[model samples]
Target: MTDQAHHETTAPASVLIVDDSRVSGRKLAKAVTALGHRTELVSGGTEALGILGEMPFDIVLLDIVMPEMDGYAVLIAMKADVALREIPVIVVSSLDDEIESVARSIELGAEDFLPKNFEPAILRARMNASLARKRFRDRELDYLRDIDTLTEAAQVIEGGAFHPTELNLASVAARDDPLGRLAKIFRSLAEEIYDRERRADLTVRTLRGTLLVIAAGSIFGIAPALGRLASAREIPPLGLAFWSAVVAAILCLSFSIGRSGLPRLKLRDLRFLTLWALLLGCLYQLLTVVIAAHVEASLIAMIGSSRGFMVFLLAALLALERPSLQRFSGLGLGFAAVAVVLLVQGTGEDNDLLWIACALVLPFLLSLHTLLMSWRPRHLGAATTVGIMMALSALFLLPFAVAQNALFLPSLSFGQRELITLALGASTAAALVLALDLVVTAGPVFSSQMAYSQTLAGIAWGMLLLGERLSPLAWGALVFVIAGFWLVKPKRAGDDFRITLRMKGNG
Candidate 1:
């Protein structure tokens, strides 16, 4: 080794030590620290797994003879994990069949083996080599991902952008390495997306477009209505969302089973599914419930009705949705409506700002979910995707509900109003999500216009049930919301068919 590298020490990487022996763990950790790396110590294999689930380490040093789950079992579990598999593991044990143990651990994906009384120099050398190998592997993976994204970009140029997917974005100007090649790729994608938008509209169509739009609308419409109901009943937002998400998950799973046979779950699949659920299912859903309980019905109606405009704007910025005059005009109308509502409402409650922030964040997260949906593996049917998200979301929310004493509050005590409200909310939530999947499947654009239903329902329920009144300005905003929907209503089918007929005539 060069004197500079030897003198400078290895880069500080995190290491996880799984050993039952306090003396062994402390000695190894001290050696790791002397080599300028961070160390974490866990007593057994199961504890190691739980800690790894919460955070990642650059390398794991596992002992094989521990009770219950030993080094071999832990090695298998790590290899089965999508996120952790890339992290190299080194087994540390002293057994009669040391040679056989080393071979088995390697097969289970361990990078190296160490003796219980390992020499300090050899341990540092092996760890450094493993870290180097990991970095090389990462670069190769990044290259493949960039190339795959480029292929998708080519498909857009060929006019197959009905369900355009967005590429992951990063500011590339700061980097001056091979990874910088991705910057040019990003610029090329943006240019291609812009060119396509200038050429012609890409329509996703079905004869049932209008019906799907209304169905999606009605399903989403119930959210605001139910929020107001929860406010009246003094029920907590967490409970309302938890049960509703549980029911929605069940309904979606049934639909998915009807479409695709039971899925064989893979490590990567579970990882991705959990991520999606955390964002839309738990974070977004919980926030929406809270926002609904706090905000005025008129304000909620105005914002809720603007979902289409939000989706359109989000997709356009990501270069996934086309930028057209009608869509732009629709966005303008939606913004104008929001402004009018703001002027009329004038932040009636001290916490209206908080409500608006929560409402805006919910749709932002949902828009992100919609964009990413197209990128998921095609074999994971839409119903299955939706089902996984709802189910995981329910699981995420359960602990919070239990902590708040919201779960089964009405069910156990038989508070008729709360029980009925819970039932209505859960049933509507399930039906709404199922309908939403179908709508987005056929046409993302039309499905987005479900905002109109949400807006109208927000107003209707607030008025008829709550006896709420709207200011003249708020009323004017309502007009803008209606007008925006009129401008961007679902397009007639057969536009593509007409083009084909024209080509035939020319021929």
Candidate 2:
């Protein structure tokens, strides 16, 4: 290193001398300055505090007998201010007051006591020790701050929104220590992951996302038919919903455990989870199952097609979505389509208007569930979250099912009803997993297109599996619903999955 750089490396600490006697203060300043350190002389503790507030100093030499504010008062003020609390203070005292002053100074957070008529060697020794401690503390604080940066960087990466240059580890990486080595490695790995994601093939990603959408939609489309089948076998709606949720919870939870261990739940998360259970597990499922028995599956699916509209409506109401002409027009068309289905198709002999109106609640409940997902706990795997929600849903349904004596258990033969119920559960779990995958891979805008596939698949499955047919007006309504979905959908993914980090209460 150059001479200048070497000198900078061994630079002396900045010392502040506080004494009521100007002569004594100047003498102490001269002594400290002669020791290759910088010094500032203050006539009283108040002046010392003023300078300390204006700039940072490595140490303070305080006089016990000061006017207005004494050394003890200054020490109390410094200790109370978080910004100045860590700066070392060495109290200066006379022989007469040395014992009591040192004892009191130490009790008031002073680092050390120095005799006013001290030897040069003793002064040098005490000052050196205090400066060394200060330097070590400053280094430790820097290291911890850098550690926090690294932790935040990791969280950002896990949230699927990482960018290059987000991790601030350059200073930490410069040090010649194990921590520095770890910082270098971590930065390299994080940047590599970012580059890989940036360089990923767009066409490949799109294809994978499309496949997931179709698979999720096709699986979801069969749910109405499955519920219809279960209902036909005299299965009570609550029993079917409860059994299916239990099956899904078991499958999802087992997979989660095998992959990443059980999730850690805080009390704060229970509110979100319980509300989600109410919307999806109990209300939506019960309504769909009950309506499936009275209304045709195809018509039910068509009404369900208004889900995007409901989500958009709720998002706008919550101020989470911005208003736009195209989106508003799309919203209008969606409502018109729903109107056609209810007024034109529901009035037909095959479908009940009451059940059709009941099915409308399904999409509203779904929209609420979708909004709720935004506030889910951060850093949880897709399977883990879904597993917990399903499990919570089962817990919520258990008491209701027991009270009604409507619990449905499969026979030893594992017949068609059992098979259908298992299929329903498996399909729900698979669709949710695929949907989450698509959202992450291709973004929510692309994934929202699943509404189209779901509607078409539901109608197809109803015809093929249940021999249900749709009226001409119903088919037209489907077209309008698809168009409405296309219009209402945001051109760009607005906010991707929001990872909420909520702290638990003391309880």
Candidate 3:
């Protein structure tokens, strides 16, 4: 029992004994050391304060009266500062018998009063009690500080600057609190969110590349048939545009099941979708075909090729797509190709410029359609959007076609001219529009290359059906198109471009 009691009382604590008299200070130090506590003796308050600043002590044994700096002064200084305020001070004074003196000392932050002839047993109890309280306070201070750190971390997360491993998890390893677990949960959540965003971004890039390739090929297949229909017949551009949209819409609309329906769209989205349909699907289509009737079909296709670059520029300006040196170079080369074609074999200076001006409008309209697709709700599936645009195009053209007397029959009967429009519209235009949905996602510079493919078909059709021919410079312009392709195809994956469109070199 005696040994256990001694063990309990003797847990080592560093104590500071401050007195001006050497004898008093040594006596207190010796008693504290005998009690199995470590002690340091200081002759004045200034020395005690300096030692306390350098080391951590559980208690300070101070005298009320000293030569220069007194115990009362030391206590006042300690209480004034937060770091030293917690060290328990027991003033050693005969004045402990005076109630007012003890009260004054206690009020100045002394933990207890010690008589000049202090009893070892009483001293042991008072010192040990003060030591126990100080240790508890220390843990609480640490815990509170850790909580403050967590608050700062929360602010950082809210500001969207969260770093996955920013927090020192080890700080809480020994802690038994809910906040530690909370910190770990937040860390996990942040990582998961960032990872998901990364994956989604990759998916969009890949999907965009794929769409551009399809649009490129699809546009080529139909331009020849379109040139054949537009030139050999008297159908107005409005009628041709409307009929093509009608045929394409019938094909695309069939695929909208299981996806979000167009009917469910909000009023604003529905209205904009209609406007988009008119601008690109109806009005732009009419203008391109009308212009194609006058200009050489291959030249029209070449001029229309600039649509991709136009969209690229718009997207970059809107902060939707990043600008790159390769993309700019490709676009620059493409325009130079357009200028080359116009300069070398332009029909008549005034006529060529006029027709080219009309063709230029088509690509700008196409750019708007691309932007709308990006801005549109994703749940409105690509097929549905295409179907909606085409349906509206056909409706828009109905009145115009009737006024021009240009619908269903070129002469109210299925002739070669009328048959070509049906085939062009149903098979080629439908496929082109469907492919266009993908092209919009792919991006402008990539999608514009479709015009390059169209140039080849336009040349072939113009030769076979309309006896058109490309000038020698037109052939060289095609090579620039190839250079443009190489410039834009990124070399690596997840480097902001994943699935790549290596446009099959024109056969």
Q: Which is the leading candidate under TM-score? A: 3
lDDT of 3: 0.68
Clashes of 1: 0
Native-referenced Cα lDDT, model 1: 0.68
Which structure among the candidates has the greatest lDDT?
2
Of candidates 2 and 1, the better by TM-score? 2
Return the clash pairs for model 1, or none: none
Error of 2 at 321 (Å): 3.5
RMSD of each: 20.9, 11.5, 12.9
The lDDT ranking, best first, is: 2, 3, 1
- The residue-by-residue lDDT of candidate 2 on 1-507, one tens digit each, is 667444443478889999988788888888899889999888888888899999889999999988799899999999999999999999998849578879999999998999888888888878877887777788889888878877876666665554546557787788788878888898898767655544444445656766775688778888888878878888877778888888888898899899888788788988877887788877877777888888778777777667766666666688655657786676567557656655654545867777888888876676666566656677777777777888888888888888898887779999987888788888888887777666666544345556545665777788888987666665666577556555644334222322222334513
Model 1 TM-score on a 0 to 1 scale:
0.49
User: What are the per-residue Cα lDDT tens digits for candidate 1 across 249-280?
Assistant: 77778877876779655667877778878886
Per-residue accuracy of model 3 over 185-269 as CA lDDT, tens digit each? 7667756765666566546655565445544444443554475466656656666776777777876777674444444556666
- Residue 140 in candidate 1, Cα distance off native in Å: 52
**How far off is residue 282 in model 1, in Å?**
1.1
